[model samples]
Target chain A: MANNHAGLPSPTLGDLVLPKLYSLFGIANKDSLYGAVAEFEDGPQLVAAGAKVKEAGYTKLDALSPFPVHGIDDAIGVPRSILGFIVICIAFCGTFAAFLLMWYTGAYSGPQIPGCELVGLCSYPLVIGGKPLFHWVFGLPIMFELSILFAAFASVIGMFALNGLPRMHHPTFNYSGIHRATDDRFMLVVEASDPKFKAEETLELLRSLGAVHAELVEDK
Target chain B: MAGHHHDHAVDSYQLDPGKWSTGRNVLAFIALLSWALLGFGYFNDHERFFQSYLVAFCMGTFIILGATFFVYVQYLTGSAWSVPIRRILENIMVSIPIGALLFIPIAFAGVDDLYKWAKPEAISDALIQAKKAFLNVGGFRLRAGILFALWSIWAFAIWTSSTKQDKTKSIEQMKTSSRWAAPGLLVVCLTGCLAAFEWIMSLDPHWYSTIFGLYCMAGGCVAMWATVTLISLGFRSNGVLANTITVEHYHDLGKWMFALSVFWTYLAASQYLLIWYASIPEETIYYKERMHGSWAWVSVLLPIGRFVVPFALLVGRSAKRNLKVLRIAAIWILFMEFVDMYWMIMPNFHEYAHGFHLHWLDLAALGGVFSVYGLVFWSRFKSNSLVVEGDMRFEQGLHFHQV
Candidate 1:
């Protein structure tokens, strides 16, 4: 069984089922570089290095730290997220949907008979405690709750969507020392796709910015 | 204290007496004019005067309670961001003793005129009769006295401890204030609730909602943050503490104002929804009166003006950080708070219950009470540093930042 799983593994049903399985598996195009990564002593050093890298005209950079380092966003020139706008839009849609649901069930009353020739579908009008059949006052609670529900869902889903999440694997994981980022080390990765990235110059830049060690990351 | 050296855009925390006195004198003038109008309204219409005065009194009382709550919370949380703005809250909190004096007219003179439960004839009603023990004028006055004393003692204890820290710069002063904060918050919350019940809820003796106190406190909380935001903005424009309190602090203040306004709306909705759903006469009558005639306009405007408008205005990151937006939002929230107070109190009066009357006395009494409140706040302002200069977290607050 170990021999069967070892070496260049034999193709299985996944290869036939998922035509792009190799790319999606994050193991593809061997000899292609992902990025150059550097480790730093601490948060401040990482922040300073981020600024230096940005000054060196590298636009595509990411940092990993055990905790949030203040001023990192500004140093790296990160744009503000559009998650709030998305949430509000989704929340308004939720509000409208909630009102529509309540109105159809609690307020709308049309002839139920198929041949009645009415303009709208039949609904059982609920008049509890003598309240009007379709008052926003009564409908407000559900509308408010649904808006929150949708906004909350949007907040989580929108955050993930913006971050391009659900990614099974990441290039940075190829670096053996990456786990130290969760402990004491601070790491910065300059993507190979950056316009200014040249492997030798990038490695030199990282070493100049007080990196304890610098190396290349690979996709496979 | 030794490490408290840093250069900033603004040099001093001391108020320029000449400049601020001009503002105080303007408040004093407004007070005198409004009080004169109140006096005229009193002799002109006895009943209207009490109703309007009660509204103003409740607004001032709630704001003070809110300030007390805000100050104590900061102490308990050991919040570094609030240290720079804590003195403003402390001034507002310490000024709370004046609420006792403000409550005098309501207690001694306006009770029978304002509260249905206080009148001998009203006691004949079964509902009022049942509430007679808690709603009687004597018990009301006694409770008001004790509650005010409790709040004053708590406010002063924390205030003196904090102010002494301005001189002492010792961690012990911080400890003492924090020590008082835990119990002080409980007492304030409880007494504030009872005060709301006894003072405002008893206006409609036949109606009651268990969430009424929280509803009132929520509005006050919103008003308190708005008041703080306005004062801080005012100081910045006047070039005092211009650098000490930054946009980050305003952002936090704006967040508070935004959040509490939503909280106030939540409480309001909870109360209204339960009453509407149950459709019981006694509980529903409160909203019934509010939703009828011209009063209905205010009822509609109350939620939209208080919640929707402010929520939209302050929801964005840029809006909270923008001083112009914050100033507009603060003033609007303060206006809405008064509107809420008016909505709660004015609907109880039978004549005004049928029609929303923006009586001249309403404006006068509001101005009169607020100016007096401002004057007391101004007096405290003169005697202390504009910020908590000696706080252990003063440096942290001075350089506070938010992304």
Candidate 2:
């Protein structure tokens, strides 16, 4: 089952790195650190640094921060979060559910008492105090609640589902520096993912700047 | 940031990470004294419900405990909109024990005025008697204790970890806090419902509402935000919080206030419609009491005053983004929340009291509640870093909250 057919799938990070070079030699000692990995302190500073890094004909960079740093979306050259798209989709389903529930309960399903008026066992809106059923007066609260309830459920459910919540494992934990993620420290670690990644040049670029420390953390 | 340090006359800016301890101490002293006087007056004036004093006491306790736990939660999660003003929330939550302590006599008074379930003779309804498994005094107190304990444990988790993180700066602690929070919030909401049921809703033995729990929560969430925003404004206006809290932050807060205000209205309407449509003998009577017999005016006015008018004021973008508008809207909503609570709770107790009842005790109680909250919140704000300086979000907040 393990080794049935074709050569192993497209290279994971483990395949790309020379473990000995990363471990004993470190970033500066490497022949091509430019594409390997570059580290920065935190998000905003990284974002600021990243924009500059991005401008310097360097298309290969990534960043990690403790909290969301605004503009990082543009700076790091990552596309906008698909979370919102998921949110929109989830919100639609939630709203539909709410509408269906009420429609089913109120209009479709009858505890269906025999009424002075009936829309075929569906609950028809009564003209109470001259307020129209579809009007804002009657419709607003449910619509708003339905939208919000769905959105709320979708937001939490979407965030978890997208992020894979209740998740007990992550590759980032392999990096010791990442431990500072919950605290004051922010970091920008350029991955080997980018095509321009030449490990030596990347390390040179990072060291030339004000980086207090330069080291590689195994993404492998 | 380099060479930007200004030492001119020592422009006094120190992050009083928390204001709760001082606020709690002061509030405790005052609350104990005032509650004592009220307790004495309550004992002398009317023996109808010896436990009635506990109602006021619980309000104070719940406010303090409720508010602080809410604050701890918002911070623990790194909630940015609330980051600037959370210390006050911490203060409010901590002050609950003070209220609990003050309510000791009331708790001791048994079910006298607090609940009809305490007096078994008064509860003839076979159905209500069946619920005694849950609605009993022993069960009620245990739940209350568990609720308070959970809150205290939560508060302490924040207090200990936050203070510990001040020096240690453990990322694990922050993650630990975040991990604990979701469950903690669930527990709090659940306890909050049972607490409301035990402390407020059960005042009338026969009456019950399933949505009552959500109703109380929606009100609590909104009111907590309003009070915190108002206090944040006070701190900002006085140059206390300064750039740490700004209109952008207020904008976000206003959005939440507006969102939750709508939530309250939804819950309120759902509960009303469910009970009204069901038209059951017991359930309909709950609405019947308020929807008619002079209380009807309040029922009518609630939608307009509570939902419609404030909803209108909050809808526009300018109101959310501008501090002046946010403040006005907050104050309006705050007043309305007070009214809304009275509408929900007082109807059960006063029964016949319609419109608004202006009592000196009401004023005193309201003042004590606010003043104690203010004093406690500010003091709590002083004790800890008003912001989670260690938070991954702190730098973003600096940019966001910057004027």
Candidate 3:
């Protein structure tokens, strides 16, 4: 089984009889396909390899490494997204929330004052530096805090969303030799279904590009 | 720090011990003495720019002192990467005492010249009167003394340990700095903040902003980065650092320069927006002086020049990789930061219709500060290894390019 899988490029569409295989294997024509696994040593190397493979005209390829690699996105031709824009958006939300919450407390959520009948919401005058909601001096602190909280929280979410986590399945997991990715290993996987892929061609390409080894994986 | 390397230097990774001159003690004394006399003449000749001269001199001094405080902080944190560069900051901070000696006027002579509220007759205003306990000379000098003592100790720690390490090559000295780093930093920040309020911000007497300390801190950090940028460029241009300081190292430094510029702007804006939005007379008066007057051009240029100009120009590729371009951006940022400090400190006198304006003496005083700053730093470089070779992070910085 080990020798059978050794050094095979990610499969090309032409190498398989899709209709018969779909019937035999009971998969939909619109099914996802997993590819052969290649391993790497460190972040920069993985990022470099991912870039080269992408430049070789393959898409739908995925990379796994022991840690996140900088430029991995551009190396694999992914477009950049806005971490700052989202932070601004969240900040906007936070600022509004802080102001509104403060206003609500000042105008309606009246604190207990002895001999003051629970003043109706409308009866209470909103006063911060006598500016009302038109200008709330006291609320400026709240506004600043809100903006900071939102920006920080959004930054965390943005980072996590970009990384994509907690999934129980990945195609690379099927590559038994590739398990070292959890340790001091890095890997790039190209799908068999990519239009530019060919089993022998990709194997040759990866090996030529200085992969230590390459082997096919069956979809889980 | 990068320029200290030479290719014959490859064979000589060790510092050239000959550079530290015992013979030039007389010459060094002459240089410092001549500049001190020259600085006094320059200030005495231009009495009209008296307030400007004092504020500018004090600010320049505070910047060096504040930066020293920051370095002590990073040292106490056991920060490996910064150790290579901390000595330059220490050298600059040593100028603070020199500056403090220079600031004797604010201690006693400038009571009538600089402050309107300092007069006993002007104490009818209750708020100003209330702050009198703190605003008085005895109190002011007392606090000033305390601030100097705290900073001197922090600088003394690095200065003494570093020179000791130079002689003995003890790793434990590094560990000693690391252990006290955390607490020393806390004191530096605390004392540094009070110094800003008592020394600079409270010059207005009535106006107060809680964010003012942070405002000084952010500016201080940016100023320090600019000083480093200027030093790095000077070395590289002289062709002293052959393979030692490469484009990759510069790219890293430029990234930091870029990051600090933006952070300073963020802090400055945060403080400004808070004060502006509140619309309180006491708080808003701080901006009123600079925002509208002969200083108006500076007020306008500050936001546009300091932040927007650097942000747009540096947010590109060639600026960071090319040393000259990065230096230009750094120079511009430094220029804008100085302008911003001018905006903060100078406007109060003129804004109240006391009839003050910017003048050329400001430049001479600034020169005095820089001349002394440079002289100290150069002397320090002569004694210590220009780069910290024994630091554990030396290898990290070397491979900082490789990966």
Top model number, lDDT: 1
lDDT of 3 at A179: 62
Point out the higher-scoring one by DockQ: 1 or 2.
1
Better of 2 and 3 by TM-score: 3
Share of true Cα-Cα contacts across chains kept by each model: 0.23, 0.00, 0.00
Q: What DockQ does each prediction reach against the true complex?
A: 0.21, 0.03, 0.07
Top-down DockQ ranking:
1, 3, 2
Candidate 2: what lDDT? 0.62
Q: For residues A1-220, what per-residue lDDT tens digits would candidate 1 score against the true structure?
A: 1336457666777656563455457755456798999999988888889988999899999999998987778777787889989999999999998899788777767656574337554567877767788888778889999999999999999999898777666778888799999999999999999999999999999999899999998766
Chain A alone, TM-score per model: 0.82, 0.59, 0.66
lDDT of 3 by residue, A12-74 (tens): 665466654554454444434467677765667667777789888898778787776656776
Q: Mind giving the per-residue lDDT tens digits that candidate 1 earns over B1-403?
A: 2222346666587788897798799999999999999999989998999898988888888988999998999988889899899999999888888888888888998889988887878846987777778778889999999999999999999999988999899999999999999999999999989988988888888788999998998888898899889988888888888888888899999899889988988898888888888888878888889888998999989989999999999999999999999999999998998888889888888888687888899899999899998999998777688888889999888877785
lDDT of 2 by residue, A102-211 (tens): 55544453355566245454565455544333333344457656776777877888778775565444444455666776676656666666666556776676666545
Model 2 chain B poorest ten-residue lDDT run = B3-12
> lDDT for every model?
0.87, 0.62, 0.67
TM-score of chain B in each prediction:
0.97, 0.84, 0.85
- Candidate 2 residues B1-403, lDDT tens each? 2212223232123544353454456667776666565555565654323323433444445445446546646656676656545545655665554444444555556455556677656578786688878878787767776776777777667655655565566687677667666777777777778777877788777888988977877777776777778877876765666667666777778877888888888888888767655668888777776775566777787778768776777776666878887888888776776666666666665533444444445544554555554454455556466555565555455446321
Interface root-mean-square deviation (Å) of every model: 6.9, 6.6, 10.5
Backbone clash numbers for all candidates listed: 0, 40, 2
